[model samples]
Target: MKSKLNLGLLLVAFVCVLACGPKKENNETETADTTAVSNEPKEFGEADGKKVSLYTLKNSHGVEAHITNYGGIITSLMVPDKTGKLEDVVLGYDNLADYQKDSPYFGALIGRYGNRIAKGKFTLDGEEYTLAVNNGVNTLHGGKKGFDKVVWDAEKITTDEGEGLKLNYVSPDMEEGYPGELKVEVTYVLTDDNSLKIDYTATTDKKTIVNLTNHSYFNLTGGVKGDILGHEVMINADKFVPIDSTLIPEGQLESVDGTPFDFREPTAIGARIGEDNQQLTYGGGYDHCWVLNADGEGMTKAASVYEPKSGRLMEIFTTEPGLQFYSGNFLDGSLTGKGGVAYKYRWGIALETEHYPDSPNQPDFPSVELNPGETYHTSTTYKFSTK
Candidate 1:
């Protein structure tokens, strides 16, 4: 009778295991799912009396990132180099106050209009609006208080591809002299493929202009440690916009043939930056925008940068029509950054993907106008790898 009871109990236990799996296994799976879902952002700072948060994203390959709601800035991006070592490749301040106080837009999101608008004025729909001139005689990066200076609302987002943050902000009408009540949504995703993708969408109640781009000063050899002069660059552009003495576009898409601006091949950034060119003289370095060579942009290769020492390669793929390659000529070692490092001139580079600068003033360039009922959307990805 005892043997019969033991056999019946063993059968019941086998049936339960088959039906419900193992309790330990179920608990382990639940714990993993909970950990991923509960990845909360920490309180970073306060801006305009609103709370600002910073999100930390990581991939299975150990690539980690820290982004803040204030300016949607990427404070740190650590990726593995050829030596299988991780390094922070972007330059940024350690605190929010440094960004607020006369920053160079390091790792921030530029928007409303990413570039200049010529003399701080533009006529849209027969109404001329004058904007605040911050960059000499032009309205730069959506005027004085651009999107880079504002605090946005951010939430963690996950997809089958990877993890990211969805940021939302509504720019009031004429917040920076732009003409609309613009609702903007930006998503920054760190994919498993070691790429950072930025997706932007916006809609305006009234007709307004929008040109958004991330301004990340990448050194590749790690941020602010050395100049990017040794980095090799290739731009998929046959033509580039020539800037005036004040660094505003001269309204011409000049051919890059036989000029230092030509980067059809992988060329060192400092190769011809000091060549006797008038355009180079005006900007003090490679600060102009190049018109991307695309058949009809779905997503095309805009540019690629490679650092030899670290063997870090970054390829820029975007739906935008232009690439602004700023060689960090304006960074003058005036301030200290993360770990008390002073950022000097040409220590970093920005390959900002966007529409042409001063597009409103130049009718020949691509349109940036987002009217009512029209959704403005664009995407840019920076793929990193060791070559």
Candidate 2:
């Protein structure tokens, strides 16, 4: 079933009601609605009574990104191909007003753990901790008020690599039932080579676990229309973690050699997405985490995606060992997006570079432990170009 948000009809009704008002003499306070539609920001008051600044990044090739302090969201990412036509490849709202209310994670940083926890419960050192359960029966993306919902502290930094932006946020001790006062720093650098390098660093006063990733729903065809099912994708993975109905890994490393999870060879995203596979049915589409063919440290190629229509290609490089490929199966057309367009199923894809989901719960999975006096450092680079 498809649905649409009738905001346009409501706006027309509002204008009609205003037109019936008595015409009065000129009054300073009664000017324009002031909230009239404009690309400019519409402030719905302050958080801590402080102004939040939005930042933009443009390269010599004219590629740019609009990022804001709130949730460190990527408002837009404009890139051009061989034809020199610019298009925003990221799916997002028109302004901060929509972002502050309801949003589907969108292009925001996710943390203290990027995926899920079983029943919002986990044990560490013989102690059990129950977290905020926001996703059905499980704890998803940290919780209801995860990092994606917070106003991160933003800073612009210039490095030899290129122009960069850093977002810093501190997770208090026992916050979200996670131990330690964890300090996190996420740096996003747009290099001259058209590579978006994200560097993550963190430290904790006590023992704590952390896995961070960006939740940017991408559609290389500019995200204006259509589904990403036709895009050819390839992930350098030989293994994938199988999940249960709750989308939590079952502590088993399954080989992708004979399954649809095999992306070692290029294949259309929708080629086997609709198969009567148990995992696909549970997720409603592809939302599994593949164990990347990386050394689990340093920089390495994780995955690559190509859209033939736009000749746009994206390569995912990361220091992490897992990549979560999410087909936008949950997007229902109820919310109006940028330019008043309704987003539909498979309208975007999110390639989240992070550790395997529920790593802390699985002893065999890669360790996400960040202990005292040790720094947690990781980086991922998304290089864009034309095929």
Each prediction's whole-model lDDT (CA)? 0.91, 0.84
Please provide, for model 2 over 237-290, each residue's C-alpha lDDT reduced to its tens digit, 9 standing for 90 to 100: 999999998899999999998788899988999899988889888889899999
Per-residue lDDT for 292 in model 2? 85
Clashing pairs in 2: none
| Model 2 residue 349 lDDT score | 93
Output the TM-score of candidate 2.
0.87
lDDT of 2: 0.84
In model 1, where do residues sit more than 4 Å from their true spots?
1-38
How much is the lDDT of residue 166 in candidate 2? 87
Q: What digit string (tens of lDDT, one per residue) describes model 1 on residues 252-298?
A: 88999999999999999999999998999998899999999986849
lDDT of 1 at 341: 90
- Model 2 clash count equals 0
Q: What is the lDDT of residue 188 in candidate 1?
A: 92
